[model samples]
Target: MATQAHRTKPALGEREMIVLMALLMSLQAFGIDAMLPALGQIAGEMGADGNDRQFVIGAYFLGAGAGALFPGAFADRYGRRPVLAVSLIAYIALSIACALATDYTMLLAFRLIQGFACAGLSVVPAAIVRDHVGGDRMARLMSLIMMIFLLVPILAPAVGQGILYLAGWRAIFGMMAVMGVLVGVWAWLRLPESLTEENRQDINLFPILRNMGTALTNRGAIGYVVGSALVFGSLFGFLNSSQQLIAETFDQGENFYLIFGGAVVGMVAANFTNSRIVERFGARRVGHAALLALIAISFAQLWSASQPQQPLYQFIILMSLSMASLGFIGANFSSIAMQPFYHIAGSASSAQTALRMSTGAVLGALIGSLYDGSAKPLAVSMLSCALVALAFVLFSERGKLFGRKVPSPD
Candidate 1:
């Protein structure tokens, strides 16, 4: 094996490429988040129980986690484009399956498949970026990608809400199907294969597994990925319970979507700030600082919720601040975790993504189970996850989260 020299040149223009990649990658997160307001309606329509309805969300993420593992190997062997194209095609079909389902079991099964299909779109873009840029430049590109990706959370809930008002829960799936088809066509036409034949490895499960094992063993990689996963799982917990929290606890009634949109605005603002600062400060520095902020906010929110006379406005404020920190943590954590294994970037990306989603699914389910018509479960979960993340960062970087040399792209 040969070591490649680090190169700083960007493969594509920043704005357009970032927007396209972000939009493609965000489909997975948006699919779950946007549907929050409609989860109850879907449950009723499908005759699902409370816990089973939550499974609809859980199963999708579980599928995404499982699906991510294989695509890295496939992308390494064949190329990103083919795997991506196939994934989008599967996304469209699964979305249609979701739309056509008449029972809870069918919807749950389709959602699982849809989650799996989304993995290619979600994971390949990051690997493609790693192919072109490394270190701070990589962090900047990721920040840009995340800045664009933030729009999905900003807009998707409103979009889903509008569809729900016009045609009900099933129409949300129809819209997803349309979005998938359009993105698929666009990808087929505009996106060139980033992984060239020269860079492609032979197809083999053993090698891929070996690479995944290597990634899992790397201390820095495991720390960043696991730390990030806890943070992501906290976010997942919020998504799982946001609708209920707003409607039941806050009594937001028909305005729950607007409240959700407000939280997304906080996220977008953070991403924009990250895009500007991540290059100068480095991903670890910015991410670790942001994680500390998250921990503080989480604890404050938990404390506030414990009060006897907590106001809805106060709850909203805390939720907004907590979500704002996510913008900083999400992209930077991913970039840092992917820093060490350029030789097996594809597999490393796969393992990291899998860990993030799998852990998120478990945490989300646990939080969902703890939902009690109040914000306590969400706040507690967030605080606990944030503390865990802080500990992981300390261990991963050996208490040196900042002032480290940024690795250049090879």
Candidate 2:
């Protein structure tokens, strides 16, 4: 019954595609950020160790990392829309399962499954974007996606807290389920298959591994992935510890979302700025300058925390700037890493995300577990991660820090 134009890729214009892709990518952030306000409630209800609540987030990252490894290959073999559709269905089911979980262990297991199912959100969209565009245009488009994606974290905590006040924490998961279904249905109706038949790969382990190997051997891809992973440790560490840091260390439980969202606004602003300037300045120049600024801010924060008593405003200001720096760094790093692998875009995206999430989860867990009733742990963790990330970036650039490469031709 549908017209031919309605069934083709042109049905969704560039802006429509960007919104859909951004929504697909943002589901993971919604899942994690919106659950922060409920962590305390869930831990108390299940009689879990207070210090161990970060596992809920860590488990998701781990499962997402593991789950991401296969989706790229599958998407490349089948088609992006079909893979995304199946993943969203499983994501919806797992969200419901999480809401029904009766114990801490059960909840964690369901969260892990939810994350695994959500992995397609992280992997497929990048490949789809790469299929359509590359070079500075790719950087600009990815920055736009990142800009939209950052908005979720800004509002997610408030949304979670509001739900907590209304129907309780479990209803948060219910909301996630409903979100998944809506997005899934919309995508099924409108998303065209980006992977053409001739470009599709066979669904074989050997070929998948081979593609991964090729991706790994590319110095630009590997360096950027490792750098991004280490840099991401700072973000993961913050997420793991933020709920406690605000509620306990700062004794601002009542104003948690307001304070958290305020800092995230800095990131949103930076992302917007990056999207506008990346094409003219190049991703490398923007990312490297931001990385340097982040490192300096990290060290400054660490120094301030070493004083007899650091001001709360100082900590918030520094952290906001750090997050803003990440806004510039993340999309550029990912775009640069994937720049060298258009032919194997799906596999490359999967490998990059899996490595980044898995490594970040481990480092974040370590940093979070070291929370010692002060901001020292977080500041120190950010500084250490930034240092390592800088080294990786320099290595990847062969000691050069600000040169831009032309996007590989499709």
Candidate 3:
């Protein structure tokens, strides 16, 4: 490890890199959010019911999570830009495949593979950021990226709904393909390789396994990764069930995107605020406070769900507040998790990201599958995940909460 990463800097400034990473990473969010409005229709047309419809979301996550394990090692061997190009290309092709699928099973299959391709987007960007900066500076950059990245959730469902109205849901995949191509072209042209020659690892299986094992067992980083996964499970569970909750349960089919976007608006604000304050306050302190806030909000959500009459406004407010807390938690958690890895950022990022995605996806699918015309399952699962996350944070801190430790990378 070396602190001289500044000497091997890419041509792009911090702002440019942040914007590029946000869009690149937002591809995955766009894939999920833009399809939310069309889930019911897709289900109806495909003649599926219950948990099967949810697999459209779950299967993609499953693939992405499983697939996330390798891209970073590959990026470590080759370079960030080329491996990311492969991911984007796979994404474009699979979006088309998903669009052309004749049945529900076929669609899920394509989405799963598309998710596999998107893993590159998830790992490479974070590795790239670590390539340039470390510690709280890295956390601020990640928070800024997240602030822009979250806009996809706010706008994508609306875009999906519009496509559902104008040309049909298949065109939404077409939109994804076009966006993929555009982003791919932009990245190909402008995004420089951040992995320097000296840090590049050979394509050896033993070291890959060893590095991945280290990533998994690093006590300092493991808790934040796993805890973040649990918190994200709450978000994923919401994604899995939100369409039905909006369209059928609440009788607000037309307002699904508006309501959902409103819920996410707070998160965007939180990310911006975190980006500004994380450096001064420290990632651990800020993230620890947010994790505690999530617990309190989850309790409120649980109470609302337990009532015979679960008010939609209460749900929306709680959703907003909970997600806002996540805005503070996610990036800082990720930055802290990647802090220990310098040269092996790609492998560490890949392993931890895989764990986060796999754990979150499995837990989310379970939560969503329990949907029974009410929000109790979601509320209970959310509180459970939040509490588990807090427990993991406690374990990571070894009973010292809100403590900031910036371990030297080199």
Best-performing candidate as measured by lDDT: 3
lDDT by residue for model 2 (222-280), tens: 88788888878878988988899889988988788887887777788888888899888
Residue range 381-405, candidate 3, lDDT tens digits: 9889999999988888897898965
Misplaced by over 4 Å in model 1 are 1-12
Q: What's model 2's TM-score?
A: 0.96
lDDT of 2: 0.85
lDDT of every model, 2 decimals? 0.80, 0.85, 0.90
Question: What value of lDDT does candidate 3 attain over all alpha carbons?
Answer: 0.90
Error of 2 at 112 (Å): 1.2
| Cα deviation of 306, candidate 3, in Å | 1.3
Look at candidate 2 and tell me the lDDT of residue 317.
89
- TM-score of every model? 0.95, 0.96, 0.97
Best by TM-score: 3
Stretches of candidate 2 exceeding 4 Å from the true structure: 1-9, 408-410
